[model samples]
Target: MNIRVNGEKIELSSTVKVIEDLLVFFELQERLVIVEQNREIVTKEEYQSTKLGDGDEIELVHFVGGG
Candidate 1:
């Protein structure tokens, strides 16, 4: 399947079916990160239930400390 990640087009395996699973696949399951799918913010509780489709766009933002 093809999905746009952070404005970059990429291809992934078909096994990546849901939003939550994708996070795990990318090794970004930590709660400190925020995920936006198709322009909507996805809650941590809903990540597991959020489904992803081909041509969908996903954005992941992580917190950093530098002050």
Candidate 2:
């Protein structure tokens, strides 16, 4: 399936069905990240149940520590 991530187009494997899976796909399961799907904020609890669809607009923001 193809979806837009932060304005970039990308294809996701068939195995990615939910938000949690998407995180793992991008190897971000262990990082501090925030996800917004289709203009709505997806809660941590919803990651497992929130299904993804084609053409869905997604925004992924991960915290980076420096300074």
Candidate lDDT scores, in order, read 0.88, 0.95
lDDT per residue (tens digit) for residues 1-67 in model 1: 8999999998988888888888888888865878899999998889888999999999999877788
Model 2 residue runs over 4 Å out of place are none
Question: What's the TM-score of every candidate structure?
Answer: 0.86, 0.95
Pairs that collide in candidate 2 are none
**Backbone clash total, candidate 1:** 0
TM-score for candidate 1, residues paired by index = 0.86
What is the C-alpha local distance difference test score of candidate 1?
0.88
Choose the strongest candidate by lDDT. 2
Any runs in candidate 1 off by more than 4 Å, and if so which? none
Residue-wise lDDT of candidate 2 within 1-67, one digit each (tens)? 9999999999999999999999999999889889999999998889999999999999999998999
